[model samples]
Target: MNDVSYSLKVFKQIGLLKPVAPHRLLGAGLQLAKWGPGLPSGVNAAAKRFPKQTAIIDDAGEITWSELAGQVNQLTQALKERGVEPGDSIAVLSRNHRYMIVAIVAVMQAGGRVLMLNTMASRSQLGELARREDASLVIVDQEFLEVAQDVDRSLVVLGWADDDAPDDLPSVASLMAGQPTSAHAKPSRHGQIIIFTSGTTGLPKGARREEPKDLKPLIAFFGAIPYRGNSTVVIAAPLFHSWGLINFAFGLSTAPTYVLRRKFSPQQVLQDVERYRAEVLVVVPLMMQRMIDLDPAVVEKADVSSLRITASSGSALAGDLANRYMDLFTDSVYNFYGATETGWVTIASPTDLREAPGTAGRPPFRTTVKILDPDGREVPQGETGVIHVGNDMPFGGYTDGNTKSFAEGLMHSGDVGYFDEDGRLFVSGRDDDMIVSGGENVFPRELEDALIDHPDITDVVVTGVPDQTFGQVLAAYVVVRDGASLSEDDVKQYAKTHVARFAVPGRLMFLDELPRNPTGKVMKRELPDFE
Candidate 1:
C-alpha cells in the first residue's frame, strides 16, 4: 500500500480518525508541541484530550488520565529537585503497577535515561547491571528494597511502598504529595529507553532505543495489530520486557484504560478481563499457556467475549498452543516474533495460525525481512538461512558499544528461517542452535515443536549434547503433565512418528519443569547434561 493510504489505515485502526472536539485537539497538539513525543508528551496529551477517562486500574485503585498526568508532573519535579539531570541514567526495578508507570514517565520527563531492570534478576545481577549502566539513581518496589539498596547509586527511591515506608527513603506517592501539579519544564534532551536482552545463555546486555524520528515505526506496529482507541487493555506481560513496554507506549497513544497487576495470576487475569470488559489482552506464550491450562469449568464460565485481541510475544507461540487457545477463546490470538535488538520481524494472525501452523506469518508494512546465507546473500525461497530485518526504527546498538551483525542495511536476528511458497516465514531455530548429527543438519525447534504436541507432555526442551559417534546428538528434556506417567521410550516412540528418523532424541531427561527466564524463553544453557 502507498504511504498515505497506509498511514490513514493505521490511524483509523487506532481510532485517531474518529471525530474529536476542536478545543481538545488543539490542547493535545499544544501539549505534544511543548513536551515533544515522549511519554511526558503522550501523558499530557491524553490528560488534555480525556481528562476524565480512566488511565490506570491497578491493585491500589483506578486513576484518571488527569490524575495520572498530575502525578507524573509532580514526580518529575521531585526527581529534578533530587538532582536528576538531563542524560542521567536511572534504573527502575518494579512489577506492573501505577508506581512503575509513574516512575518511568517521571524519569523520561526529567530527561534521564530509563533503564528497565528485570524484576526476576538476582541481587548480584541487579547491582552489576546498575553499576555497568552507570545508573545515578535506582527506584525499586518495596519487595526489592534490599536488592536496590545493594546497587551502588547516588540516590535510592521507592517506586512502590506501604504506609510504613522508611522515613529516610522517598516513595513516588511521597514525592508527588505537596508538589505542584502543573507541567514541568521540558528537558533539554529526550531521554533514551534501554531494554535488556533475555540473557538465557549469558548476562543480559542493554539494547538502547531512541525516540522515533517519525510515525513510520508506529504505523508499522499499529497496522499489524488491531488495537482501537478508548478501549480497556489488560497488560499481563511484564513491563520490563520490550513487548509489554511497546504495548504500554501504544496505550499512551490510544488513550486506553490500562489494567495492571503486580504479579501474573491466571485466575486473576481471567477475572480482571471479565471485570473490566477489557478489549485487549497482552501476554507471553507461557502466560497464555497457563491461562489456557486453567480448569475447563473456569475457562468456560469466564466472560471473555469482550476481548478483541489476545496478543502474545517475547517467545515462540507453539503451533499447538495457539490452536488450543483459539479453539477455546475463538481465534483472538496474535503472535509477534522479534528480538530486543531487532524490533518486530513478523506477526502471526489468526488466519495464519489456522492456515499454516508454526509459521511466523509475514512482515508488516515498512518492514524488510530476508533469509541470508553466510556470504550475506539472499538465499533462495524455502532455503534455510539466518534472518535479517530492517525497519523504520533500527536498534541503536547496545549500551556496551556492541551491535548485532549487520549486512545490506539489515540487522541480523540471529535466527534461521525460510519463506514458504505462500510467503509465510517459518523460523527453524537459532542459528547457533543448529547441530550436525550424523552428517545431517538438525534444528532443535523442529524437534521441540513435534515433541510438545505429545498428549502426556506439558512442556519440552530439546538441545544438542556431545556424542562420540554423531559428534552431537539431540537430548530431550520432557515435563510430563501432572499425574501423567511418561517414559523415555514413550518419548522416543512419539518422536519417531512425528519427526525424521535422525531427529529422534538420542537421550531423554524427565523434569518437573523446564528452566525459563521471566519472559518465558527457555533457558537452554540451564538444562541439565546427560548423566
Candidate 2:
C-alpha cells in the first residue's frame, strides 16, 4: 500500500471509530514519522497534480499552483531578509483576500508561526492580543497599517506586492521578485497555531495545537472528505479564525482551489460562486441568513450550478432557515458542530439536516461522543447531559495546564445534549447559560426562540439576573423591528403564551441593537444585571 493508505489503515486499526476498550485495548506500539519539508510539503504535491489549475481567486487576482509556489518562494525570501527566522511568530491582520494566502505560505515556508490577528478587533484589542502573543513580525494591508503603528513589532505592508515602498515597510510584491524558488524547511507537526475562539466569551484564551499524533486525523478526515483536490471552495468569513485555519489546512492536505472575499456580502457570495464556478462553500448561519434576505432574484440570477455542498457551522441552523436554503440553492446544506478546543467532532449531513432541523448530527466518522451526567457517569441514551468526545484517534488536547478537561478518556464539550432513538444528537443549550430561577431550570435558547417568534422582536437574548427572592431571575434583552414600539408587557404576554409560565422573562429591555462579538454570538455578560 502507499504511504497515505498505510497511515489511514493504521488509524483505522487503532479503533478510530470506537473508544479504546479499557480492558483489552493496548496502545499501538508503532511510531510513525511525517515525511517532507515545511510549506513545500503539500504545495509541492499540489503543484505537481494541477500546475496550471487556478488554486486561489480573489478580487485582486487569480493564482495557479505554479504561480502560488513561486509567490511563496519570493515572499519567504523577503521575510527571511527582514530577519523573520523559523519559529518566529508572524502576525497577520487582513480581510480575506489573495494576499492573505500569499503571506500564510510565506510564513510557513520560512518556518515561522502564523498568529492570525482578528481583523474585526478594535485597535486597542488587536494591540493587546499581538502583545500577548509576543509576535515578532506583523503583515497587514494599507487600510489596517495605521492600527499597527504602535503594535511593537516590525511591519510588512501588503496590497502592493508589485511596488517599491517608503522607509522601513517593504511592498509585498517587490520582496517576491528575484527570490530563489527552492529554499524550504520542514514544519514539525508539533508546531503551534494560537486560534482564539469565535464565541461570545470576552478575553478569549488562545487555543494551542500541540500533539503531533492529534494533528493527522484533522488532516486525514477534513483533508480528504470536506476538502478534496481540484474542488472550488468559497470562503466569505475572516481567515484569522478556526474555520479559516481549517480551510487553510484542508487546502494543504488536499489541493482544493479556494476563493476568498474581504468581507461577507450575500450578493458578493453569489457573484463569486458564479464567477469562480465554486464547487463548495463554507458559511455560518448568520451569513446564510443575510444571503437569504437578499432579493429572491439574486439567487435566481446567480449561476451557482457548480456548488455541490454548503457546510454551516459556528451556530444553530433554524428549521425554517434550513428549508429555505434548500429551496433556494441546488447544493446540499450540512451542519458541523465542534469547538476550538475540539476540531469538528460531529457533522449533520443534508439528509440528517432535513430529517431533524436542530440536531447537530452524529459524531464524526472517526470520533466518539457520550452524554454524561454531572458526576461524569455516562447518561442514558435519551438523557440530556454534557457531551464528552474522546480523542483516541490522534486527537490533540488543550494547551492549558489543566488536562482534566477530559474525564476518564472523553473531552467534555460543555454543551447540554441528548441522543435520539436514531442516535442523532440534539443540542438544547449551554450548561453555563442555563438560568436557574427559584426552583426551576430555564434554558435561555428556549426563551430566546419564543421571543423571536414575536413579530416586533427582530433579535433577542435571554440571560439570568440576581433576584433578591428568586436567587436568579430571567431577563430578556431585545432589538425591536424598525419603527415598531414594543413594551415590556408585550414581551411578557408573548412569552407567557409561547413559553412556559415559569420560563417567561420577568424583565424586558429594548436596545437599538443587541451586543454581539465579531462572530455574531450574543454577549450575555454585557447584558444588564437586574434584580
| Runs of candidate 2 exceeding 4 Å displacement | 1-40, 153-168, 187-191, 210-228, 392-404, 453-457, 481-487, 525-531
The estimated TM-scores of all candidates read: 0.98, 0.85
Instruction: Estimate, for each residue in 1-531, the C-alpha lDDT of model 1 and write its tens digit.
Output: 789998998888887777889898898888878876667778888998899999999999999999999999899888888889999999989899999999999999888999998887878888899889988988999888877667653478888898877888878889889999888877898878999998888888999986777668778787878899899999999999999998998668888999999989999999999999999999999998898789999999998999888988999876488888888876888889998889899998889988999989899988999999999999999999999999877688899998888999899999999999999999998999899999999988888899888878888888898899999999988999998997789899999999998899988999989988778998777888788
Tens digit of per-residue lDDT, candidate 2, span 102-188: 787678767676776666566776677677776787777767766776775445566433333445666576677788776455544
- TM accuracy, model 2: 0.85
- lDDT for model 2 comes to 0.68
Model 1 steric clash total: 0
Candidate 1: Cα lDDT at 27: 88
Candidate 1 Cα deviation (angstroms), residue 291: 1.1
